[model samples]
Target: MMTLSAPLLALLWLVQVVCSAFPEEPGPLSSIPTEVRKYPVFLGRPHRSSLRQEPLHIQRILQVNRTLYIGADDLFRVELDNVVGDEMFYSKKRTWESNKNDISICRMKGKHEGDTLEMVGETVSGMARCPYDPKHANVALFAGNLFTATVTDFLAIDAVIYRSLGDSPALRTIKHDSKWFRYQLNKMVVDTNAGPHGNRTVLFLGSSRGTILKFLVVPNQDNTAPNNNVFLEELEGYNPECGQDTPQARQLLSLTLDSNSHTLLLAFPSCVVRIPVARCQLYSRCMNCISSRDPYCGWTRGSTCSFLRAGTLPFEQDVDHGNTSYLGDCDLLQESYIEEPDGLVSVNLLVLSAVSAFSTGAALSGLMVCWIMTVKHRQRSRGGGSGPGGRRKCEKEQNMLG
Candidate 1:
């Protein structure tokens, strides 16, 4: 039996990419085919492209550990200290140069809120040399230390968040062969759900090469030590081929997952794009849908993929509880859908405007009739031609004139 070598395997992967269908921005929902319209619109938001500019689009901004999201709301009753999280990011300038002084220099730092990144924090400077690279900083609210999740069996002391937590520290390391090269770690995103693993957390790490790493963030149940286990794993890979020959090739600078939409939005130097979780419906057959194990997808009647609901699936509640196996009963989803511009919303608005115009016209006509009658009454009073006597007077006057 003959097996393909690494180079041959890579070449085959590239070939598959060349043959794969390129992702196109989906058309307006109204224009979607009738056969496909009934299907749910998942990850494709109203955005056609990202909001970024050239020169402002720096690839270095998307480095791993360079950007990290720390959510305080996720922790239940964990204690927090100011000293542990005082400096959010490492000094980019200090890291590249040979400075013997054990101080991290950060010229720029900003706090992100909503759609704005405000430069509000004090300029972080003259900090003690952190044991680990700030890019690998992974710590929980329970403990303010930082830890880098790696596949290597042996632990790097400088990268450990907490050296000791009794028997087991609140840290995880996976012992496996390293498939992820290009250690220029680019981004980290924390994911939390409300189902069975509600207590458990997931981390999405973007590597410099072009891969997003998924890890189950293990926190210590008790105040003592954690379960001494590897927390990170290579769960899924969305490596779209960077075809050198193809005109459209993307080198990912950053990765952000919309927890609500279950969409993975990737930022490149010049532009941004998103991966729709709803495309799981492309699995038109029951066998393929179930085997794929996508949380957002379910097999429907006639063996077509159907979206169970909007947004990212709650792993334990939706997948573990068998929501992914839903077949038929699709009518229940009729009410829970996005309205198209040329569809329901426009029709409703049109009807409302027509009704308003009709009402205004009727009101004006009635008022004009009333005003004309009032004017005629006043004129007749002045002319004395309203009552029987006034009628006789008008006849006498007509006779006189004759």
Candidate 2:
């Protein structure tokens, strides 16, 4: 019997719709591997008797063509196919000496080594300096540059991108807000094929808070311009309601991408999860798919969402604008979602609720009036002694007595 205010009813409706759209306890989408192979790539010891034994911590390892480039206490390279099986992989590796004592090799001097990777006379003099300190698992090579996303000091976190220019390497560094210590960035993966042109460098950064942030780095055609890196979005890796014991358990340690499958792998302290690079399946309807504004997804002719690859004809997508005008007379548009702030509702819902309340009140009022009138009519009929029949009976009784 309670009549809720229009605004309150509208807010309740909005909450219900949003909750239905995105469930709190989401169902599982994929499975994790129960078993994986473990292999040791490198060993750290006093290389044939030295004065000191420097700790060997590999910061990053990347494979290009057939060669595997490693960033560790010293820059190392080996054949990718050779680093497998038993003790046969160990060979006489050529090491380069640097004048700097604590040199964590984060970049390679390709020109100095040239066609012949001569061991003698080559040094770590012309290589780029290591951008990250305590450099362990904080570097990525993407689009011909070395990128590091790590905490520089106690209060500063930075994402530095650098590359070698000519025969002599010069530093071309772009730091993404060193002063921004909101979230400690753990690891990063760069994707150059994010857009149609394949020039838009998209960085997927894993943070310490179990979150992956996507950034779109604008190409610096003019080197003098300031860095134009745009923050795209942040994806949640852990649900807070799952009740983790410690914050360390939620930290993401590794981020890797498989281009052939278009899958992004995330490694945490507790488990490893694989997610699609573009989640097109979430958009079940045509309107949702078209409005997602994701370059990697589209609504296909099969009436399902799928990856927008080459020869994917008759697919609907608008990455730049998400314009729905292209979808002429879409029946699914009615099911489109509307996002509103909490404790607030749209004007259309408010008006509808007000009209509904008014109609309900009017119906109740009419029912009350009809009930009262019916009761009064019954009382009047009873008092009149069933109309003329009661008067006739009284008269006949008096006549009989006389």
Error of 1 at 127 (Å): 20
- Backbone clash count, each prediction separately: 6, 0
**Candidate 1 lDDT over residue span 21-140, tens digit each:** 665432211111122222221111122243212222323322223232222111111111111221111111111344645343332334356758568867732112132334334443
TM-scores, one per candidate: 0.30, 0.38
Reference-based lDDT, each prediction: 0.41, 0.56
Q: Write the per-residue lDDT of candidate 2 for residues 1-402, one digit (tens) a residue.
A: 989999999999999999889734322222112111121123322232433223433455454665544455565555534544311122334466765543534344334546775587546532233433353335545545443333333323444444543354545556566344556776889888874445346778878776676665666788999765656455665533223536755656567775655655554443334455665665666776776666677777756767777566877776656688767766343232333477887555676899999999999999999999999999988888866888998889999998
Overall local distance difference test of candidate 2: 0.56
Candidate 1 lDDT for residue 148: 31
Q: Give the TM-score (vs. native) of candidate 2.
A: 0.38
For residue 54, what is the lDDT in candidate 2?
38
Residue 80 error, candidate 1, Å: 34
TM-score between model 1 and native? 0.30
